[model samples]
Target: MRDPNPSETASPFGPVISAYSRADAIADGVLVPVPESIAKEAGFRFPVALTSAAWADCVKWTDADSEAQPTPQDETGRLWDVLYVTAHAMKKAPGDREFEVRLYRVPRDGSTGHAKPARLKSVIGPGDDLSPVITIMCPDES
Candidate 1:
């Protein structure tokens, strides 16, 4: 019979390999922590973070980008859009621990266009300390 707890069983392959924690990811800039006050305003009771890819896709805006694009946009507005949509989605499904959310945001790329639709995945899971937390990331990201 196999052990239900893998940690209790001896691995045939040998000792455990390398592992990365959520804290490590945040420290390495792979994940960016959203301000607690802003996250609370967006209806998140727990800590929230965004994967670097998602941040680049939606939150990273600059004056140069606004000048290049026809529509004027700012980082605050972009981040709010993401958080608002994600929060609404979570409210719609209160029982789900993990789900995907679709939101529209203007692309930061130097292009003239309207807000483009993007899919973000919201996961409510345990953090480094086994505390509930939320992480929003692009569909392609982990």
Candidate 2:
């Protein structure tokens, strides 16, 4: 859906976020920059809360034909301190779209490089003085 403010837009699937610039941070806030092509295909001026990606040996998720559950494991096989960005995106095409907000690991190099996926545990609502929070269960957590 189109937002009243042209500078920002809402995600049809998840939280509305502006385009990610060098200044944006994942842990700092929820807003993040996603693949422009993906955003364009999803008809979102802003970045979606979640998207599929593969980095180095890390694979958040892929465009699988079937909807199978993900294993309770990370790409690293161990835990790593990473930034978490919650966004949403259209899984498929417009006519047959599946909107979802999956947590993604923001790369440490400040570059949208080969980042992994953060296991989605829960979606927490914003507090009286807080915004929407996406709770991710990282491997590092006991």
Candidate 3:
């Protein structure tokens, strides 16, 4: 029997191309998976992850970073700030699946400064299994 979907059969345009999946992104380190417990504590109902860029920018704190800055920072605290702000932003627009949140996090670079305001884009979209999942990334990211 012929399939109703054009892509199911031979495509008139060209051969079908395989696309990268969310699992592939996670495995490739492009997406960093957040602990389910932490996510739930932040009011997330589905699995949540952060883009590599976002993770590096907001959550990657180290001993060197602490010594460089006047105030100390930790990965756990930074991660919580990101997730908590994101959850609050989601609540502000419950009907929207995609939104942007502004958050403050100290830069990990060897620069002595206060927390810088940054924008993160949040998307509640399908995962590799077609289940609802949330991915937090920089505004410039996909």
Candidate 4:
């Protein structure tokens, strides 16, 4: 994953190139990397779970809001940089869960739960400005 905090602290989230126990270990597991198109289309984030109460720790596959406040905006009129986080629940049948994309604003602190970090702003999809779920992210942002 690129530095999770790329704004200033260096992206904590990026390509994770590592070695596993064995080739079968990789084969036996179902770890699917986010496709390049999905990353580009969404801006800069990958699939994640924000439900974790503690963002610093990857407790579960859930996204969460770490800081109690929203991330401060920069020079641009924008409040945050675009970064989509697709969330999916594993299926019993297994292959992979049908993922759902949610925009997230990854603040400079390497936390996806920040109030402002370009994340999903629409419940429908990206570039979708017409909807009740303008802040498709955590209810707090809305």
For lDDT, the strongest prediction is: 3
Q: Is candidate 1 or candidate 2 better by TM-score?
A: 1
TM-score of 3: 0.88
TM-scores, in order shown? 0.86, 0.21, 0.88, 0.18
Q: Give a tens-digit lDDT track for model 2, residues 15-133.
A: 64555432343444433334456544534444333212223223343323113323333432222222222223222323322223344554333334344554532223332235433
Candidate 4 lDDT tens digits, 3-91: 87566774467555764432232255322222345444654343321221212221112222323324433411122122223323222
The model with the greatest TM-score is 3
lDDT of 4: 0.31
Error in Å for residue 18 of model 3: 1.5
What is the C-alpha lDDT profile of model 3 across 1-142, one tens digit per residue? 7678866677677865888999899999999999999998888899999999999999988888889888798999999999999999999989899999999888876775788889999999999889999999999999
lDDT value, residue 127 of candidate 3: 92
**Tens-digit lDDT track of model 1 for 3-23:** 799876778788868989999
- Candidate 1 vs candidate 3, TM-score winner: 3
Which structure is stronger by lDDT: 2 or 3? 3
The local distance difference test score of each candidate is: 0.90, 0.34, 0.91, 0.31
Task: Name the Cα RMSD for model 1.
Answer: 4.1
Q: Is candidate 1 or candidate 2 better by lDDT?
A: 1
